[model samples]
Target: MIRRKVVLHFPREKVDKPIVSKLVRDYNLDFNILKASITPKEEGLLVMEITGEDEDYRRGVDYLEACGVEVQPLSQDVARNDERCTHCGACLAVCPTRALYLDGESMEVVFDREECVACELCVKVCPPRAMEIKY
Candidate 1:
């Protein structure tokens, strides 16, 4: 079964708890709250993972959109220039998804794109601007 996932960024005040609850009650979907370091005080973001038919994914997306939540497709682009990386592991420390790792033996940067949420934390934290996120 294919699982479709969406990440939504919303202002804490705008998140319709009732709507979200309704969706969970109506459809068997998984919802995760991601705390944002930048906006620590507010309800940062919502990561919704739904596994079902393609139509169900579409409906979920549409429903979330109708509820005024801005939905975006998650991408994986944590470390772009691994070759040029100085193995500082600076990006690894700030990676939101733990996508960047430093090999203990070589100290080389290892990027797991699948685990990347494309939050751009690594890009912002890297001093050399080694991590570039396209989206």
Candidate 2:
């Protein structure tokens, strides 16, 4: 299966649709919603991980675009600058996936990129501004 992280932008008119559910029922794809902001009559943002056969994934993405939901890679949202990081471990407390952790021996913060789901929690909490979200 191919796995991809993506951000979906829903226009006001499409905000109430069961778009993600359709990906599962119609396209036979699996999805995990990492973050979401969906308010009635307003634009919505959904961060999700989509998994399926390569062809199915492509078709599902096409379907979303057809429905007027803008799709972008999740990597575009969050990043950590190691050069600016002091390894103070402030991000560790808020990382839901344990992507940010403190090394017991070294007493320094470590970032595991693969474990990050791009939730933007670290970006908001980082005092040194090492964690940044490109939006």
The model with the greatest TM-score is 2
Q: Model 1: per-residue lDDT, tens digit, 3-122?
A: 645677766766435566655566555555443322646654766555655665677778878877787766544448866677788876677667788788887888887666667777
| lDDT (Cα, 0-100) at 114 in candidate 2 | 73
**Model 1 error, position 1 (Å):** 4.0
Rate residue 31 of model 2 by lDDT.
93
What's the TM for model 2? 0.78
Q: Which 10 consecutive residues of model 1 have the lowest summed lDDT?
A: 31-40
Tell me the number of clashing residue pairs for each predicted model: 0, 0
lDDT of 1: 0.66
State the lDDT of candidate 2 residue by residue for 1-135, as single tens digits: 899999999999988778889999999899999889988867999999899999999999999999999999886656789899999888988999898888999998988877789778888799989998765
Best by lDDT: 2
Native-structure RMSD, model 2: 2.5
